[model samples]
Structure formats: C-alpha cells, structure tokens
Target chain A: MTSEIRQFLFESLTVMKYSTADMDDDTVLGPAGADLESLALAELSLRVEDHFGVRFEEDEAEMFAAMTVGEFCAEVARRVQTASAT
Target chain B: MSRGVAVTGIGLVSPVGTVVEEVFDAVCAGRSALVRPPEGHALHGVVDVAAIGPAIDPESVIPPKDARVVDRSIVMAVRAAEDALADAAIEVGRDVDPYRVAIVLSGVGGLETLARQAVERSTRGRLGISPFMLPGVLPNMAAARVAIKFGVRGYTSSSGTACAAGGQSIGEAVRILRSGEADVVVCGCTEAPLFPTFADAFGNALALARGWADPTAASRPFDRRRNGFVLGEGAGVLVLERAEFARARGATVHAQVLGWGATSDGYHPTTPRPDGSSAAESMRLALRDAGLSTADIGYLNAHGTGTKAGDAAETMAIRGVYGDDMPPVSSTKGVTGHMLGASGVVEASIAIMALRKGVLPPTHNLDDPDPACDLDHVRGEPRTTDVAAVMSNSFGFGGHNVSVILGRAGG
Candidate 1:
C-alpha cells in the first residue's frame, strides 16, 4: 500500500510537470525539491484524495510543500486504511 | 516629457504565423489565416470562421500544473514577450535597471479562461474549482504573468481600450519612456476570445461575416461584398526603448515611433462616428507630432475592419486628413481578420516592416472596392515603394482612436 501510494504520488508529480527523475522518498514535495507551489500542491493533494477515497485536512494541505514524498505517501496510506475501515 | 521612442524588437503571434519575417512574408503574399475552425477545434461549431493562430501548448512555456490553471492569453503574451526581449537583447536588471523597465500589455484578457472556468464550476461544484482560477481569469493576468515571468518590476499596467488597446499600449509606453519613468518597455496586446459564448455575442449581433463558402475570403475589408469583420486571436509585442538609450546600447532599431495621437469619438458604444472627424483629428495630430505633412507619409495602414460602417468611416477619416491623394493604403485585416486589441500593434508592426522592406502588404480579398471607401487601396498584390515613414491606425468599439507614425530605422 505504501509503495502504491508512492507510485501514485510519482505519477501525480509527473502530471503536474515537476521534474522527478531524481525525486525519491526523501525528496521534499515542493520548493526545495519537486518545486510544486501552493496551488500545485493543492491540486496534487486533491487528486490523491479523490483517487484514494481519503482527504487531507486544511492544515495538511498548507504544509504540503514542507512534507517529504515518503511522509506524504505514508500519510495517504494511513488515511486510505482509515477510510476503508470506517 | 516628449522623448523619442524606437521599436527595437518585435514579437508577433498572429494568424499569419509567429516569426516576424515569416508573418511579414505571409502578409505581403496575401496568405489568409482566416478559415472555419477544424473539426474537434474548441471553436469548430461555436462560430463560422475566424483568423485563428496555430494551436499552442500553454505547457510549452508554463509548467503543466500552472499552465493548466492559467489562461491561454498569458501563455501567448509570455511567448511574445520572450521573443520581443530576445530580439531587442534587453534584459531587465542587467542591460537596464529593473526599476526602469515597464510592461504595458492590453486586451480583453482571459475571456476564454473565464468562460471555461464558469462552466467547470457549474458542473464540478464550487469545491472542485482550483484556487488559481480567479488569478488566472482576471483581465490583467496576461500582463501580470508576463511581468512575473521576466521579473519586470516597474510601472506595469494594462489597457482595456477594446480594439485600440494594442495601439494604446504602444502609445502609453512612449509616454512612460518620455516621462523618464522607464528606459525600455515591453508593450503590446494579447487575446484569446475564440470561445462559444463570445462567438454567440458577435454572431447574434449580426456583426460577424457569414455565408462565405470559402472562409479565406470572408474578411474582405473595403471590398464591396464585405459584410462584417471576422474575429481573430493572437498577440503582438514590441520592445520599445527610448531612442537615445537604444542607440547608446547599440540596440537594433527596427523603426522609430516618431509620434502618436489618441482620441475618442464620444459618439456611440458600438458604432463609429460616420464622419470620422475625431479619427481624422487623430491622424492630423500624429502627422503634426511627427513634424510631417500628409505627403511625407508614403504608406498608410488603415483601421479598415471590413465592416461597412468601419471601412466607410475610416475612409472618411483618411480623406479628411490627406484629401483626395492619400498615401498607398491597405488593411491587413483582410488577411489577418480582426484581432481586436492586438490588431493595433500587429498592424503597426506590419507598417514598420513595409517601411523597412520598401514593400507594402496588400489588402487581401479586396476584389471589389467599396465606393464609399474609395482610396489608394493596395489590393490584389503587394505594392513596392521606397517610403521613409508610415502611419498605422487602430479604432476600437469604445470610440477609441489611435494613429501612430513610424520612421525608417535609425532615421
């Protein structure tokens, strides 16, 4: 599930036109790394939420740029499990 | 502050094509870009015919995520702005002070973006809308995006002067440079108004050319068979620099904007003043400002949009200014269609090219000239002339009239 979430994030970043050839689990999702801005982050988060049937809280959306790829993927994995259980 | 201004660089994305030389060649050869939008085109069924530029991928300039959010108007503006800057070899903060540069882009920007976003909100709900929608849809966003792309942090603004916006931008740039506010200005207009809703407005108003089996012949400016102007989309940008500064910097001067005149008809919202008194006044003012007599201007780029009222009024204005023996005149709109605000600068560029090449681009589709628009029309074939100066005119729906005079490069 974590790998699946990571792959989804990679595909989403590619679609968003972020240079992800050197992107990795440790890569920051935004300015310091993939360079996604607030708007792009919001778009990526929404796409993830819709695809996984999970959601990012308002604060999480704001911190999207600060989170690493691994951290974001793990968070989405947890949310997907929670959504399924609920 | 009446400082001399020179057009050092020109960037155009018109129906004729993007490259400056190529667009000039197409115009001189009378190649029409007006046609029925191809099947599966966004405007295929929205309107009958328009002078449409080639398909552009906004992502080619902007990042995909951001490109998808912003309007096509921004994309075209940035492209033209880039080309204009490269052509002039002017870099903000390097060649000239960043604070001493300005951008005066003009047009009804983001119309297609606004229309598309409104539909998305209706179908996808409010929450599904991107937060970037508003920023991307504002009329000034095209100018803003270009400024952001180039780090132009000077007196940046846009003109909403309808079809005259493009001409007004150049005029405004001259004003800014003359005032010593900026040494260089990236001035022009961009438009992406080829959408269904906008098409409906013009179509229902009986303002669009119709019943033309061959779309290429639809935009017949000054022709007796002309019905109305065909709409077009594109951007035209000019890198205007203070003449002294441009010469000092060893810039490649294309043509010097000797003078410009701006006026208002104050007549009607949609109709031109039949007498074209104010429009003629603008021409007289431009000639006077340029320190030239009517005979000095060897070529005239007219504001003839192929519409009966517009062509006739412009003819009156031209005759009122130059009398019976007017300079060789042509309206490129016969080929380019009416690009609204962008037409002003694009036509100005064409006039400058004509001056440089000693060849005037002919008015396409002028098979039968209207008696009311009787003038020295450069019809059927390009006219070669050794002209040192030229006048380009642009008149908009809001009674806005602008006539600009350009002299030979370095002269």
Candidate 2:
C-alpha cells in the first residue's frame, strides 16, 4: 500500500515538471519533496481518493500535511481499514 | 511623494507578430492582419473580418489535464508573462523577492468557457457541468494563473473595464509602484475573444467593419470609407519596475512610465462623448501628472478604432488637448485591428518602440483621411521623427477612458 501511494505521488509530481529519481516514500511530501503548494496538495488528495476508493472527511483531510509519503499512505490505509470494519 | 516607474520589458502575442522587433517593423510597414473567417466557421457570414493571431498550443504550455479546465485567456496570459519576464532578465524567485513581485492583467473574462458550459448544462443537465466550470470562467483567472506560474506572491489583481482594462491595468501598476507596495510588476492584458458568441454579439451590435472584398483593407481608421471596428485577438505584457531598481540591477530600461490618467464619460454606455471633453480631460490629467505641457509631447497613439463615432471623438479629444499645434498622431489599429481590452497595452508597447526607434508608425489603410479627423496624421509610410514622449489613449464601452504617457528611456 505504501509503495502504491509512493508510485502515485511520483507520477503526479511529473506533471509539475519534477523527476521521480529523487522522490521516495521516506522523502517529505511537500515543502521538502517538491515544495508543493495548496493547489498541488489538493490535486494530490483528489487523485489519492479517486484511486483508493476511500473518502477523507474534512477533519481527516489534514493527513495530507503528513511529513513523508509513508506517513500519508499509512493514514489512508488506516482510514480504509476503519471504514471497512464499520 | 511618488516614484517613477520604468518599463524594462514588453511581450506581445498579436496578429501582426510576437517578437517586439517584428511587430514594430510590421506596424511601421503598415502590414494588416485582418482576414475573412474560414469557410464552415460559425461566424463566417455573421461577422466581418477578424485579426486573429497565431495559434496558442496549450499542450506545450501546460499539462494536458490542467489545460483542459482553464480558458484560453489564461493560457495566452501565461505565455505573455513568461515572454515578458524572460525579456526583463528576471528569474522571479532568484532575482527579486517572490513576495515583492506583482501581476495586474486585464481581459473580458472567460466568455468561451461560459458559453460552452451553459450549452452543456442546458442539454445534458447539472451533472454534465465540470467541477472546474467556475474557476475556468472567472475574470480574475488570468492574473491568478500568471501569479501562480511565476510565483509572484505579491498583489495580484485583474481589471474588467470593458476595452480600457489593459491600459487601466498598467496605470494601476504605476500606482502600485508609486505606493512602495512592490519592487516589480508584470502588467498587461490578454484576450481570447474570437469565440463564436462574442463575434456574434459584436456583429449584432453593428460595430464590426463589413462589405470589403479584401479583408486587409477592411479596417481603415480615419478614412471616409471606414465602416466600423474590426475584432482582433492578442495579449501584451510588460515588466514594470521602479527606475532606481531597474538601474541598480543593470537592466536595460525601455521607457519611463511618466503618468497615467483615468476618467468616466458618464454619458452613454457604448458611445463616447461626441464633444470629446471627458477624454480630453483624461489626456490633460496625464499631462498634468507628468508635469509636462503640450509642447513636451512628441507623438499621440490615438484610440481610433476605425469606427465613425470613435475616430471622430478621439480626433476631437486630440484637438481639445493640443489645439492648433497638434502633435503627430497615428492609429495602429488599422493594421493590428482593435484588440479590445488588449489594445491599450499593445499600443503603449508600440509607442515605446516608436520612441526607441525614432519612427512613427502610420495608420494603415488611411488612404483618404476623413475631414472630421483632420490632423497631422502619419499615413502612407512611417514618419521619421525624434519621439521624446508619447501618449497612448484607450476608451472602453462603459464610458471608461484612460491615458498613459511614456517618455524616452533615461528621463
């Protein structure tokens, strides 16, 4: 799941003229990876939700502020698990 | 209590040409870009000839998916902005503080997107409308897109004053610099007004030139045979900076923005004051703001849109301001066609070029001047003269009038 999220992020970064050679799960997602702005972050969030079939509530959307790609993927996976159990 | 602003760079994406030198030469040579609509076009029979510029390839400028949402006005604005910054030798985040840079763009909003989406909503219902519909058609999107692309975090704004928006944007930019708000500003206007609905509206208003066999000869400003204005499309952007800032950075200054004046006719919605008093006041205000007299001005770029009312009114305004000693005047709209909101900045750029090159561009197709527009009109060929100062005028549909003065570089 972490690898899949990392791949998705790397692909999205390509549209912003960023190369994937340096981007990774352990690398910081924004302000460190590609210095993404609010627009780019929102776009990334939309893409993530579309691909994973999981919804992020207004409160949980702050998970996008997660420092690294791994942290963001973990948050998404946790949300999906909780949703399935419910 | 004000500081002077200098124009360091100019970008043009117009029907005549894009490169500054090429456009300057074309305007001087009296080249016309107006042409009849291609067969099968929606407005082929409804509208007259249009001065359409070269195609703008969105795939090359923006990502495919991103380009799909925004209007072409935003695309053209971004292209012009990039060209302007490159010409100014500015690396926004590297040369100047990103936060101290500003953008003031002008346009008539995104009519194309609005027209298209309205149809989709009517035929296919609410779900057919894209989520990006609102963002695509907003009037401020051009400025916003340029700000986002260039990382110009400071003061981003747009103007929608009918046709005078471009000139007003530049004038507002001068105010911003004078107020010590920003060190640099990317200012101008862009328009994607060639869409069918817009063409139909202008045609329906009887504001477009018609009945000419040769489209190039259709826009004859200041000529007795002139019918009406020709609808043209293009964008022009200029990089403006404080005189001291440009000099300190060893940048090549193109011209100094001496003064700007804006006023309202307050009479009619589309027609200018026939007496031209209010327009004259705008010119006088600009001269007063520059602290210069009539004798100081070298050339006048009239907002002669090849229409009977507009041309005569602008001529009256010129006579009102200059009296018997009218400075040499010409209207490049005969060649470039009226670029609507973008005309002021484009003509201002051409005025700066005239100042730099020492040649007055002629009013193309002005073979027989109208008796009402009797002035020292530069016609037939380019006039060789020393232009120390030039005043460019723009009047929009909603009675908005603007006059901007630019002096030769270095004072």
Candidate 3:
C-alpha cells in the first residue's frame, strides 16, 4: 500500500507537470519543495480521492502541501485503510 | 480631427494562421480555413461546418496541472497577448509604465466552459464542480487574465456589444489613451464557442451555414447563392500606442487608427435595419471623425456575413454613405467564416496589412455577387493597388454598429 501510494504520488505530480527528479522523503510539497499552490494541491488531492476512494476536505488538501512526499503517501494509506474498513 | 492611434504590434489567431504575417499571407492567397469538423472533433457530428483555428498547446502557456483548471479560451488569449507584446517589444514597467497600460478585451462569455461544466455537474452532482469554474466562465476573465498575466495596472474593461465587441474594445482603448489614463493599450478579443451545445443554438436558429458539400465553400458573403455565415473560433490581439509615443520609442508602426464610430440600430435584436440608415450613419461618423471624405478611402472591408438580409443592409448602408464612387470592397468572411466578436480586430488587422502590402484581398467565395450587394466587389483574385487608407466595419446582434478607419502610417 505504501509503495502504491508513493507511485501514485509521483505519477500525479508528473502529470501535473512538476519535476520530481530531486524529490524524495525529505522534500515537502509546498514552497519548501515542489512549490504546489492551493489549486494544484486541491487537484492533486481530488485525484488521490478518485483513485483511492478516500475523501479529503479543501482545508485538508492545503495541509497536504506542507507534508513531505513520504508523509503524504502514509497519510493516504491510513485514509484508504480507514475508508475501506468502514 | 482624431488622435492617431498607432498599431505597433498584431497577434492574430485564425483559421489561416496565428502570426500576423502568416494570416495575412493566407488571406492574401485566398486560402479557406473553413471545413467540416473532422471525426472525433468535439463539435463533429454536431455542427455541419465551421472554421476551426489551430488547437493551442496548453502546456506551452500554463502548467500541465493548472491547464486543466484554467479555461482554454483564457490561455489562448494570454498567448496571443504575449505574442502581441513581443511583437511590439514593449514590456510593462520597463519600456512603459505598468500603470499606464490598458487591457480591453471582449467576447461572448464563456459559453463553452459553462455549458460543459453544467453537463458534468448534472451527471455527477455537486462534488463534480471545479473550484476554478467561476473565474473560467466570466466574460471579463479574458481581459482580467491578460491584465493579471502581464501586470497591467491601468483601466481594464470588457465590452459586451456582441459581434461588435472587438471593434468597440479597440474604440474604448483609443478613448482610454486619449483620456490620459494610459500610454499603451493592449486591445483585442478571444472567442472559443466550439462546444456542441453552443453549436445547437445557432443550428436550431438556422443562423449557421448548411447543406454545403464542401465546408470551404460554405461561407459566401455577397454571393448570389449565399445562405448563412459559418461559425468560426479564434482570437485577435493588437498593441496600440499613441502615435507620438510609438514614434518616440522607435517602435515599428503597422498602421495608424485615424478614427472610429459606433452606433445602434434601435430596430431589432438579431436582424439589422433593412434600410440601413443607422449603419450608414456609422460610416459617415467615422469619416467625419477622421477628417476624410468618402473619396479618401481606398478599400472597404465590409461586415458582409453572407446572410441574405445582412449583406443587403450593409450594401445599402455603404451606398448611402459613398454612392457611386464607393471604394473597392471585399468580405474576407468567405475565407475565414464568421468569427463573431473576434472578427472585428482580425478584419482590422487584415485591412492594415492590405494597406501595407498595397494589395487588396478578394472575397473567397464571391463568384456570383448579388444585385442587392452591388458595388465594386474585389473578387476572383487579389487586387494590386497602392491603397493609403482602408475601412473595416462590424455589426452585431442588438443593432451595435462600428466602423474603424486605418491608414498607412503618417499618410
């Protein structure tokens, strides 16, 4: 699940036209790293929601930008587990 | 009689070309961009025919992710605006004051985006709506996006004068410059009404060209067999600066906007006044403002939309204004199809190019001119003449009429 989440994360960023070459576990998604803005983060969150069947709020999507790629993937995996268990 | 507005740069996106010179060459060579939407086209099987401009590469202008959210129409306008600025070699805050530049663009609001989004939301419910939908569907977003992208801080406006919007926007730019509100003005319009739903409106109203075997032959303005105007999608942008401002900056001058006139029919919403008295007044007002008489114009780019009543009314209007010595006239719509609001600036750019080349482009499909539209129609082939000045007119639904006069720089 973690690896799949990571793959989806990189693929989404790539499709969004962000270069993920230098990105890794420590790189954040916001200005500190990939520099995705509010709209872009919202779009990325929606894409994840569509793919994983896990929902996210608008405010939660903005918080995604502050998380590192590793942390984001982990958060998504936790949400998917919680959504499917219910 | 009027302040000379210098056209320093032109960016034109049409069925023929995107570069001003390329579009000019195709128009001069009489190549038609009108064609039936090919299979798999979004409008294919919906509208019988149209003049579709080249598809813009979204990634070129916006980030791939953001491209999906921003309206296609806005991106195209921004690209054209950028090209116009590059052509003029003017940079806000560096070459000219950022606060002294105005952006006035116009078009039928975002029918394409709105119609499509409405469909998606209907099928999927509330969550289907995108966050950027509101800004994408706003009519003023064209001018707003241009102003935002370029950091233009001066007066920004959008005209909703229907088909006359493009001309009125330029007229408004001249007013803004003359008001001492701006030094350089970015003026133009963008339209992308190619959706199936939008096509249905014109198709149902019987306002679209139909039953033509060949799409290129669909739009025949002033021709005896003329039926209706073919829908076209594109944008036109031009950078206009004060004549002295352009001269001081040593910018290349494409043409000089000597004068402009705008009027209303007060008759009908969709149909023009049959007697064309109000339309003729528009021409006379333009001439009066330019301090030129009827004999001064070398060619007239008419608002002949190939419709039965529109061509006749415009012809009567021209005859009422110029009578027997009417200048050589043509309607490039036979080649470009009707671009609706975008036609005015595109036609004005074509007229400017015609003046510069001393060659008048002929009406593409005007093989048999109607007796009602009788005048010296430039047809069969391009006419070679040392024309110094030209006129381009645009009339829209709701009776809006605009006539703009262009002349060789300092002529």
Per candidate, chain B TM-score? 0.97, 0.98, 0.98
Candidate 1 ranges with C-alpha deviation above 4 Å: A1-8, A20-26, A48-60, A70-86, B63-65
**Per-prediction TM-score, please?**
0.92, 0.84, 0.92
Clashing pairs in 1: none
Better of 1 and 3 by lDDT: 1
Residue-level lDDT for B20 in candidate 3: 76
* Models ranked on DockQ: 1, 3, 2
For model 2 chain B, the run of ten residues with the poorest summed lDDT: B124-133
lDDT of 1 at B158: 94
Which candidate ranks first by lDDT, i.e. highest?
1
- Each model's lDDT: 0.88, 0.86, 0.87
Q: Which stretches of candidate 2 lie over 4 Å from their true place?
A: A1-86, B40-42
Q: Tell me how each candidate scores on DockQ against the true complex.
A: 0.38, 0.09, 0.33
What's chain A's TM-score in each predicted model?
A: 0.93, 0.74, 0.96
DockQ of 2: 0.09
True contacts kept of each: 0.35, 0.00, 0.24
Model 2, C-alpha of B174: deviation from truth (Å): 0.8
